[model samples]
Target: MNNPNQFIPTPYTNSVDSGNFTWSAPSNIALVKYWGKREPQIPANPSISFTLNKCKTITTLSFERKRHGGFSFDLLFEGQPKESFKPKILKFFERIESYLPFLTDFHFTIDTRNTFPHSSGIASSASGMAALSMTLMSVERLLNPEMTDDFFYQKASFLARLGSGSACRSIKGNLVVWGEHEDIPQSSDLFGVEFPFEAHEVFQNYRDTILIVEEGQKSVSSTVGHDLMNGNPFSEARFAQARTNLTRLKQILIDGDLKSFVALVESEALSLHAVMLTSNPYYILMKPNTLAIIEKIRKFRSDTNVPICFTLDAGANVHVLYPDEYKGVIKTFIDGVLSLFCEGGKYIEDKIGNGSELLTVNS
Candidate 1:
């Protein structure tokens, strides 16, 4: 499964004249952030994430047999034709066409919608691409009915990574690790693997309440941010630090050490931004409200002795993470205090979840 050649489909044993598939894939928050990457969507450092529940993307792909031609596809977002999204889809098709040869043999209509706002830094691309990859795998399965469940998911994740590196982690649930980490068995840079070890019960139902400090599009794209790492003086040390932190976090997960968890997760989040701040063409993604929320979270945790912590994506939004047992107190804290920092008081309540779902398939 590690070899990319294994994912290439053999000649179709069955023919599908027309078919449709629908899948829903959830977004994921990296506990060990994956900030930089190599070419072909490979990560520079290993990372693990908690798959989210409420924030997800649902996609339906319908295809009809067409005369042999180049890739032909139409994309719709929330039932509206979105021309801007086609280029990305087209590029994804080009990247994956070799693996799924049937792509050019059919005309595809991709209809997608996201529960969370797009490009607002909730990893919309991760969920969106994961959902699409899962849907496409259904078509592959139709052509090759003998495909095993393991092979199906592995290929889906592999394809998703080609679309977005983080998207691979969105394919699985609860805990997923991406990149070749020595401490994590079965870890691979090619696709995300389920965390093999059983985590302490305390982490089973962890909650993530995303405080949307600023929902507008970020000034710098993640692609540009990753590129800036090329000349970052601290790039090597940062990657080394992430590896060490991941090893420490693995033990913390098993022991259910909330204190250590809080420290590591927050440090990793800040370090991710620190790397950005120190890059050659440095830029800041955190807004004023973002810093305000972080300070408030720290003050509330110190005053109340609540095991709450904050993590940020490559955007201004802050993900308020806490154990499920403390949901009641945390909800009050968010409502009374944190919401004031959010734009229009916007936020999303979510929790750890089991991964993607195949909703329907018709042939």
Candidate 2:
């Protein structure tokens, strides 16, 4: 048999039968949003994102040799068994099994918990799937032991993309780029690569305060929305625009041009929604409060010149991004002006992160 590790050019051997490993992976907020995709979870456009610190998922996988030799696993969310999550996990395993033949040799028990609520405008799938990918990579290393960090992360990102396209970006810290572009030599639609350029300190440590405009499930799932892009009148233009914006945003990040950053980020957010409106059999994901939050943010920016901006992720919630210097001022504004529009006046305080981490391993 060809060495699977070298074949994909990707893992180790472990004697212990029953063992556990855990990883904490942060969710990423795309500055240049990934609105559309191709088959097998490929991004239709190049996108970049800030990997957020406080919004993350911690997942632990317990593994034992399967007596009968078939793939099997159990999932728990927040310490409780969540049957609703099993089907998706099964489907994900089915999709990636070819790349990970060892999966059929073990039975896994996965426990996952998030700092933020599920289906509440956070990229739960991104963090969740990324964490799972890390655990699987850890196991692969334990079994094969020959891979380098580059191969490990590349394969992990590749596996994560198979689960959720955005999850691929969550594997790295600070800024990450996904999807191929002429300007970016190594970028690919199949997996994300870390943003190659050094970013200005101001943009590197930016804060993302999530304004919970609606703390409920989106009316249209991101999957459905992506599928609708098949015949979207603006699909071609949007893809081209994303490529162009990614190039511009990279320069802005390096130059520390907050003005252009704000304009581009906000426009990208709005343009994402605009595409939904102009799609065939149109639908709207932004709620009344979502608009209110945007208006309040714009007014706040104009009034105070705090260099703050907003972005959204196919939902009503607003992510108010700004420099750390504006934390006190922005918090005051959130309390006095923006809180009313949020669901139960809820919001999450987050910042650029240090990427995914392996928490523990028990053998």
Task: Measure candidate 2: CA RMSD.
Answer: 2.5
Q: Give the winner by TM-score.
A: 1
For candidate 2, report its TM-score.
0.96
> Highest lDDT, which number?
1
lDDT of 1 by residue, 1-363 (tens): 367898887788998799899999999999999988888888999999999998999999999999888999999999999999999999999999999999999999999999888745688999999999999999999999999999899999999999999999999999999999999998999999998899999999999999888877888888999888889999999999999999999999999999999999999999999999998788998889999999999999999999999998898899999999999999999999999999899889999999999888888
Q: In model 1, which runs have C-alpha deviations exceeding 4 angstroms? A: none
Query: Where is model 2 more than 4 Å wrong at Cα?
Result: 1-16
Candidate 2, residues 206-234, lDDT tens digits: the string is 99999888876788888989998999988
